[model samples]
Target: MESGKKGGSMESEKKMLESNSILETIPRDLVLEILVPLASSSLSDICNTKRSCKTLNELGNNSYVLRYVSLEGVEVVQWEPSPELLSFLPRCEESGNPEALYRRGMVEYFCNNKHEDALKFLERATNLGHEEAAYVLGIILLCNKDESKEWGIELLNKVEKRKRSRNIGLSELRNKCKAIVRKIWLNNVVCPEEPLCSTLACKNNKRKRGQGWDLSDEDEQVMFDCKACKWDHERTLFHNMLCGSA
Candidate 1:
């Protein structure tokens, strides 16, 4: 049995080596298609793949790989990176990577208070099919200027229908966004007054808004029907959350 196990392991190794040899013969562009996903999945894996052979090493460090590099567990996303590290983000942005745009947008918007720049980055990210970027962009729109509310709601509704994003649930995404808001807006974040629902049921019931409720959640949405009030409640709700404990 031990000998059989050793034989199987050797067979697997041989097959892997054969595959590697075959991969080296493929067109560089085709190899890049494989490299891009590897970069997006894990930077470490890309490095390992590059180190495994000379051919991969030559192709791995190009613009193609940097454009789709994953930032999921990268240090920059968790905190402000130093100046030397700053250039990395722009390099990734030059490739139009959605994750890079979203990360850079979050920092610029919340930390640097560069709303316009952040929005541009986020909009690009959303255009690239980033679900989280869409959610964050939608929330920012809803709570900000009046002209963008409709567009904000449209983006959010798209987010609401999706069950999973970046391997996290909808609730997790809400919590993540709220956590960032809480850390940044540590004071009273509420609007001056409730946007007030015009419908009779909303007026009579007056389900108080901004008490840590998710705007698009079914349970919360069921509590109010007026579109105006619902948006208002959600807008204030985000504000309240932003002001709440981190």
Candidate 2:
């Protein structure tokens, strides 16, 4: 058991180092700037990359990155309405990368309501230490039609256990997940049969309302009707100009 634990730790450390080395070859500050706003799930890849080298150790050591990512994780775990924060999400899916795959799953599961496949990717992610995966797992267990809060809490507790050793707590995480679930569920229950009252309002703003007659349309009609009149007027003006010249 001791050798197994030590071997696992060493392997993880080595993997962290190798990943960090690749990132170290590049400038650190630039990477941080590009990474700061990225969603937590995506950031995990960056962290993993940073862990591969000693020179990149500082990248992993950044408390700001950790805090931001943690807050994001909390929001997702709790199911907060975080449309704005989602700007950090990667525009394209990095499905080939396991970490990216999991992040994509989380975004789909919560924000976009693609729950079926979310479970598959998230399960794979949890095996790889993607904290967000654990959060989702807890939620699924708790909220599944046949499941109970007890099972959900157990999953959450497992996450907390991992966090406690790492000095991260599940309290905030649990709260965030619960909050998100509440918002989504409430939205479902109260959501309109057709659409929200806001949809028409949104559409109204999108469509430029004609103040009276659309000036462009009126101008077109006038142009057609006045074709003969305009031609006659031009002819008379030209004749008068010729007469005056003569």
Cα lDDT tens digits for candidate 1, 1-246: 999999998998787677678877799898899899889889779868877666677677677888787766565454567773576667778888888888777777866778889899999999999877887788788766477867988887677657433344445555676655544533323342434354555552355544554444534324445556655655555555555543
lDDT assessment of candidate 2: 0.48
Which candidate's lDDT is highest?
1
TM-scores, one per candidate: 0.69, 0.33
What digit string (tens of lDDT, one per residue) describes model 2 on residues 1-246?
A: 999999999999888767666776778787766555663556566556565566554554464454334333433333454664343333212223334446556556655666777777777667667675676665455444453445545666677567768776444554443444443322111011111112334432232233232222212122212222222222223223223332
- Among these predictions, the greatest TM-score belongs to 1
Q: Pairing residues by index, what is the TM-score of model 2?
A: 0.33
User: Which run of 10 residues does model 1 get worst, by summed lDDT?
Assistant: 185-194
Query: What CA root-mean-square deviation does each model show from the true structure?
Result: 7.7, 25.0
True-structure lDDT of candidate 1:
0.69
Model 2 error, position 12 (Å): 39
